[model samples]
Target: MTDPATLSAAEAARRIRDGRLSATALTEALLDRIATREPGIRAFVHLDPALALRQAEAVDRAAKAGRVGPLAGLAFGVKDVLDTADQPSQYGSPIWAGHRPRTDAACVALARRAGAVILGKTVTTEFATRHPGPTANPHNPGHTPGGSSSGSAAGAAAGFFHAGFGTQTAGSIIRPAAYCGAVGFKPSFGTLHRAGMKVMSESLDTIGIITRSVGDAAFAMAGLTGGDYGDPEARPGRAPRLGLCWGPTAEQAAPETREAIERVAAAAARAGAEIVPIEMPEPVAAGLAAHALVMNGESADALAWELDHAPALLSPGLRERMEWGRDQPRAAKEAGRAAFATARAAVASVMADVDAILTPSAPGEAPEGLGWTGDPAFNSLWTLLHLPCVTVPVGTGARGLPLGAQIVTAFGRDGEALAWAEWVRQAAVA
Candidate 1:
């Protein structure tokens, strides 16, 4: 029989609400898939089948009692960086080996409020930084599944979970989602609550989700995004116009990757949306460098506790980066901020003609080896601008693997970006 876990959360919820399928059966199917794939995928850092089933059962019971919401009977996988009261929120570092939280992160609670079953936590790079996790791409285990939110995308792509939660400081969400061939959504900065989420770069970290379909990603955003927990900057609005640019950054993508995006752009243009390719004003490389600068400057504060004594427990990649950040002069941090401001201003000029911007989700498809997580060169600029971004799978790559495109919105216009993402995905499939 086909795996029930392969169905999107929105689809599964309908089946359950109509009594066409039991939530328990669906949860069992996912748990079984995870049982078979978890060993090889390592997508999950924690797994508790009993708890998941119990939650599913309760959801089914609630639905039977005429209680159901947008996510009734749906299951979700959260990243390790997000605190779960039931699961240990180890920051993927040995120093916090047994750490647990007494309260759920705001994002986790939001999922629960929507009646989602918390399947488990997925792997994240050490402290959601440069260190790669053990999770492999389901498409080709020989290759690396992108870093940080590695397991979340792998689980969704491998049919273990229909949808999973992830976060992006730089490319923790979109890069891995691209590499894994899944739909990744990073709403404009603070669109989703970040309370209880482990801090990487306070200014850059944003909550995101991964799913098999843009429709499902929208279903998730309908619930995952809201006003704010505490961040006053989280207010959101609508977006109408869209900015298009296929310049230096497009040139930067691997040849095959660029073609995939081109195919999608053509299809999008035919679908009645305006398509305008403009000059890529800001230096793409400079945005990446500034991201590194700020990331390094603030990382010391986030890792202060662990770095104080168990410095050796951190991964070499993270250790080296921390040390690099430690030595960075205050001037570099200021310069990075100044550079980000200039880029934001340039982005504003681009946004004037469009409601949002369209960009390639990744430089290329998932790379061949797992030695290093693929580059996040294409994603960091938007992250630095603190805008919302959603990755919609538009086509297969040169080798038949999935390829995705990024829908970037003006800062605080997350809803508009998501609407465009929905239209693009629908158009792509059509």
Candidate 2:
């Protein structure tokens, strides 16, 4: 039999349901893999092997009784920023260290009820802000795994879990998944409920999923929201009309990113996709700048208590940004919100001719150091506009690190986004 630890969530669930694999056996294989690789990866901040086994055992027993949820036998990691009753919901900060919630975050609760085993809580950046955590890229330990969804991406890539819950306030979900050579699906804003999450920027904080394959992301989303995100193997009836967009951040893209985008475009074209070279509308392009102002302003308010009472506990950089946010003129915040509103209203027309926009997922491959989490220039605009986005690893860069292509669709088109992402992935690999 294939190594159970490496199977995708969809495949694992199918195998378990088919009576070919037991949840307990799959969980044990993953635990064994983690025991050997976790020390160096540091992908998880909290892992209780016994608890994981207990969940898996219960799943196995439930299977015998013909009671199975859609996600049975699938093991997943929860980002630390999301509350988990069994594990500490430390938002990657010293101030909230060992913080536990009385109930699971909505996403976690839904996953658990759907029969997915909670493997552990993955590390997150402090307050899911600029400050990164200890997680290193699973591909190269010297490089970063990206943040603030660092551990979720690294864990999914390292086979520690089949899927992971990630949140994006900016590019947390897609950027990390790109850097770690995994698939990231940042659904339309509010597609997944955010109750019990440490939301830094309410406008931009979107819950997402990261997995080894686009199909796995679809599977996880179906279980989490009970939505028909479609099967990974199901291809669209016709080749999609994909807009090949360089976006406003094209100048900032490394050679690897540029090359990767062009390569994927060429491959997708050959596979019958209509690759249109489209320019972003002015209002939408302006949202890149607006994203920062809105994030900073909202984050300042979100962390006000922390800044007021335990200011010393906050990171120097975060404190400085929050202070700046606190002092910003009300007009500044309003202008930022206005920019987003304009962009969101204008984006529909921009996407009217294309099924989705094809862009770079990051500036380049994972950088050589873990200090910085690369740039979010390519991703922030879409996030600010409330678009659905997905990233799939296309190839490697000069540094042997992975590069990814992002597929973005209009708001409320998450299903289309996931389907198109799978198409792009197949085209790139074919």
Candidate 3:
């Protein structure tokens, strides 16, 4: 049976506005489903039935008054890595098990303003890195769900909420969405306010969202996007030229991903959009490596105290990464940042001609087994330079798993990126 909890945010809002649904009933319905699915999925680190209902009741009351706003009565599951004043947001590590904040992150605040119920904090890999969380894929329990947004993707896939929020330091958002066969969006770097999200590597971390479809993703983003949260220089504007790059990514893509792109590209061609083939500078291939250096090295600095105080609290592999982060040379960090800047300039030249670039969101379908999460090599470049990006689900892979093609516009061109992604999404649908 298709669960009411599985409906998208837009659908939920429309139902509520028409008085066909009450926010309280929707919240309870989602909680019931979460209670059933969470035992195996372990998608949430925290759940507050009372608070969720309380918020829902407020929405219901508002609707009774005919005051329903754009997102009135919607619900969302958030990654534990993002701060939430109301819940115990443990960072998937035992060290901070009872941690709670006094305020919601900027993104959370935005959602609340739009009348979204804060369902609860979802699971995240320790500090949003490679350390595995308990989250498993919703499709097959034996397969690994990707991270560090494991819980957010899992929750959305399992119908726990209309949409969910996750952070992408290193494919945390896109990889998990692909693994869960859901649509995920990582807005261009710095577009979404990160005032309350937990800090990983300041250089690469991005706040992102996961939904059932690209249209849902755009709906969720419309509320949170604009200027740099409150910064004047962070303002959004017209989208730049769109450039298309596939070969650099295609060279190493899995067979399934290649086929999905071929199918999507052909479909897009039929829709009358220019599908150009272009090569990224040789340095982009190196961007992944550089991203690793910045992520590991900077992460070492952010969690140095944790590593020193509670090494046993983290997963074994993560502990080793900390040791590695501690020992990695200073030169790697310098070189990585320098290379990132250089690559940004090189990419800018291409951006001058095109409004955006369409690339594969992941290498292929989510792999089976639960040991390790999927790869983020394909997602590293844009994350590094903080470029605004959107993932358009083009089609399914060999196993019926979802596949995505990413649309990347220049940094801060989030509005344009979303529009182009919408255009591509509708074109494919047609």
lDDT per residue for candidate 3 within 1-430, as digits (tens), equals: 4455767777778888899888998899989988888999988888889999999999999889878876777788989888888888777778988998899999988888888899988988878887777788898778777888998998888878878998998788877887787777787777677888778788888898998766567667765552322211232243233455773556778898877776666766776666777788777667656777788888888888888898888778877877887798888788988888788877777776777787788888777776678888678777876787777667777777767787777777766676677666665666
**What is the alpha-carbon RMSD of candidate 1 to the true structure?**
4.4
Which regions of candidate 1 fall more than 4 Å away from where they truly are? 1-3, 226-242, 246-251, 282-288
Clashing pairs in 2: none
Model 2 TM-score, all chains together:
0.98
Model 3 stretches astray by more than 4 angstroms:
1-7, 15-20, 62-69, 225-244, 247-249
lDDT (0-100) at residue 239 of candidate 3? 28
Query: Which residue runs of candidate 2 sit more than 4 Å off their true CA positions?
Result: none
Candidate 3 matches the true fold with a TM-score of 0.89
Number of backbone collisions per candidate, in order?
Answer: 7, 0, 11
1-430: candidate 2 lDDT, tens digit per residue: 6899988788899999988999999999999999998999899999999999999999999999999899998999999999999889889999998888999999999998999999999999999887888899999999999998999999999888888999998999999999999999999999889998999887889999999998899888998888998885798889999999988888999988898899999999999999999888888878777788889999999999999999999999999999999888889998998889998888889888899999999999888788888788888888888899999999999999989999999888898999999999899999
Worst ten in a row by lDDT for model 1 = 227-236
- The candidate, 1 or 3, that scores higher on TM-score is 1
lDDT of 1 at 366: 85
Best by lDDT: 2
Q: Per-residue lDDT tens digits of candidate 1, residues 1-430?
A: 6567778766787888788888899989888887888888889989899999999989888888988766776888999999999988997877888898999999899988888889998998888887777898998888888977998999888877767888888888998898888888787777777899888787788888898876677677775553321211122333234466553455579887777767767777777666777665755446556888898778876887777788889887788888888788988888887887777777676776776677888888788777788888788877887778888777777666667888887787766676787776666667
Predicted candidate 3, C-alpha RMSD: 4.3
